[model samples]
Target chain A: MNAATTTRRESIGQSPRALPNTSSVPPRSLPNDEQRLLARLRQSDEQAFDELVTKHHGALIRMAMGHVGDREVAEEVVQDTWMAVIESLDRFEGRSSLRTWIFGIMIHKAKDRGVREKRHTTFSDFETFDEEQEDAVDPSRFHRSGEWAGHWAFPPQPWDDQTPERLLASQQAVQAMNRAIEALPVTLKDVLILRDVEGVEAKQVCDILQITETNLYVRLHRARERVRRAVETYLEGCQRAV
Target chain B: MAHDASQSVHEEITCREVVEWTSAYLDAHVGEDRKQQIALHLAACAGCGAYVGQIASVRDLVRLLPQTVDSPSESEQVRQAVAAKLRRQ
Candidate 1:
């Protein structure tokens, strides 16, 4: 192998012998990429840090916005998070993805900022109406008094020809899904952004949101159902159009 | 729910109940008994089964989208600023 490629690999915590057989590992895990990135970040490499910031800055803002409400405050929280990330570099142990580690810091900062600004109530106030919110399954769509009572009134059809290809090619359907995400209740929106958008685990979502497991489950399920309904609605619209 | 009235207590969950419990089942948060109840409901109910599939698709599609919905240009600016600050520190 060339000297540069070997150097890059070794920089990422892989020995020269570890180079040939990466097929067993998931490409997305990219332990080598992370290790190299972490090393560069530790040394305050400007270009390396810029790449990391570009990849995750938007996500950090959205997560901070979940707690702080105001966009400006959210931006501030994200900026503060970067500072904290710099300070906490020594504590990172590769136990979790670097993304998750940085996010944990952002969540902590956002939550603290929210509390200091008395915005925590905005984050927590929705729990009371949690019961009154529409359920994942609309009761009106179910029968009320027969063998199928409480069952689906209309069968759930495939969003398209039951294929991922159709959905991927349909711009309207994609737009509908994005719109639905934006329209969700803030409580559900936050959970969806973290769990689905940020790709955080459910357990970690609970910790970040300071919600119970049950609450996290409810919010996540409701978010998924709503997004599914958007695709369903788009398909129905296309059917009517046809 | 009434249809299951004649079934054993373990199989008494309705479509609505199963819908409410679906996330619990998927997340493995419910007890084994409740898991069986949901399983029985899904086994017998085509609609509920489809609901499970559709939600999985929803998750897949969302993951396909960018992790953040903020405009790309704005994100670029934020990243540049953050990088500059990190270097200054």
Candidate 2:
């Protein structure tokens, strides 16, 4: 093989996909295209900035929506995030990517908005988080007539078919999730949303939240567990109907 | 009341350990040791197991929900508004 071909093959083998997955890779940096665009953006290239905004605005909007749950509020949050990105351009140290930088801004803006609205649903009641209550599941409530041991032994059934009804059921489940998330303490909710829902890495969550890795994991663990408990109880009711 | 609070606190396991092991148990993250630890703990501790099961259920439920995020209609509106505002600057 030619030297160029051999070199290309070696490079591909050394890429990120070849590496073992670990939390070492920090989140936020410029993708090649984004880096190029940022250079142009620094020059005040309007088209480049426009393209960047178009590509990312939708995602930012949805992220805002998740935090606040109101369309208008979400739109405003994204708007403010963009404004912050523009205003802070001079200070952009390129420590994280422009996207991460913008998201950091958006998260703060959305959370601040959430606090300001102070309008929350009844879902935040502390009584609902009582993990002890889950143990009260009545054996009689389940159709345990069959071998209880065998029942426990069997794997959980795969989800049923995709249908409109299934879709609605799932939406209800997500609503339950959102409510559960909304009920979490602000710090926990931020970690859970950024790490779990947004699929950001652990390192990124820690960076965005300005928390140590240990503290980040602690908050994430508690937040995730709380959301799990709430969603489980919600689904348990749905299971009864099936 | 004192007894109940103490028992509940005593019952609490390391949230970090559980969270660390859960991804492995769920097969999203891999490591036999973690899965084993989580499985063994779950077997011994029903409450933590229930909590684990709840997380798995929530992920499954998200699959059933509608794709509501970043709907094209709303997205375009926001895009135009932001673009206009950016242009003004």
Candidate 3:
């Protein structure tokens, strides 16, 4: 599904709520690529920092945007992430890629933001919804017609030869999927986000998360299942309506 | 044959085994025997396989979401904000 429909912007021209899509951009890996850039950045090279920011700004924004769901808030988070990165460069031990380091800081910032947001207002409890059996209502009870499954065959994938109209519809589904992903438990959310969205390798996720490979996999596996169910349930609802 | 859902611990995957397999599986480092075991379990166990598939979809969905690019000027706002902080440090 196109990601735009599920992600509504506060304004017509404003950026939509960001989904954590990092794999397409490879900055999360390549420790050496980062090292070279950091070397220049450390020398007080304003241009170097500018280059780094320009290259990474969108991904970072998207990253923060996923956590906060607001463009202005996400923008601030990215700025804070860069500031934190600059301040901590000297302490960076080349243990992980610069991207990971920056992201770690961003996650912390995002979590902090989440805590504040939680205290200010209550968010809807999606758990009750999750608990409801997806097919429990027995789609047949309502329609009395042929099953909806025949009309639907796994919505065309995002990269498929989708029409502009179809793509737009798909984007909405993706946006809803993003919300479900965000609602996942932190442990599962982090593992899935890092492994799937960011496209970090299993080894990198383990290193960055400081968890054993075994633990990471279990979390990843379980997390993936949750997100998939969430996405499937969402699409199923849309299909039934059609 | 499907293992009895009400079977004892001995009849089901132990917590330790699940942990061990999960670790190896994450690293893509599981051996053939354990791999087969996991695959068999996953294939027969809709719940477990659904778990694996969800993560896969999440990963794929995240990868496929189109990036929301902003103007260069928006980035400059970040640069300017950080530059002041950088000067102090």
lDDT per residue (tens digit) for residues A156-211 in model 2 = 22333342244345666567666666666656666666666656776666666677
Q: lDDT, candidate 2, residue A59?
A: 55
Error of 3 at A65 (Å): 6.7
TM-score, structure 3 vs. true = 0.58
Q: How many angstroms is residue B15 displaced in model 2 relative to the true structure, after the best TM-score fit?
A: 11
Q: lDDT score of model 2?
A: 0.54
Q: Write the per-residue lDDT of candidate 1 for residues A1-242, one digit (tens) a residue.
A: 22222222222333334334222233344488787777777777878777877778877886676566677788878777776666556545554567766776676677668767663346442232364476777778778888877777876874433555577677777777877876676578778878877778876676556677778878888888888888888878878999
Query: TM-scores of the models, in the given order?
Result: 0.73, 0.56, 0.58
lDDT of 3 at B80: 85
lDDT of 1 at A219: 83
Q: List the candidate 1 regions with Cα displacement exceeding 4 Å.
A: A1-37, A65-73, A91-97, A108-134, A160-163, B1-9, B66-68
Question: In order of the candidates, what TM-score does chain B achieve?
Answer: 0.72, 0.53, 0.46
- Docking quality band of candidate 1, CAPRI definitions: acceptable
Highest-scoring model, lDDT? 1
Q: Please write out the lDDT profile of model 2 over residues B1-89, one tens digit for every residue.
A: 10112223233334334544453346334344444455665776554565466556554543344334556666566556656755666
Relative to the unseen true structure, what is the C-alpha lDDT of residue A209 in candidate 1, on a scale of 0 to 100?
61
Angstrom error at residue B73, model 1: 3.6
Evaluate residue A15 in candidate 1 and report its C-alpha lDDT on the 0 to 100 scale. Answer: 38
Query: What is the per-residue lDDT of model 3 for residues B1-89, given as tens digits with 9 covering 90 to 100?
Result: 12213333333442223322443454456655555566655655543453344344455566566554456789988888767776776
Cα lDDT, all candidates? 0.68, 0.54, 0.55
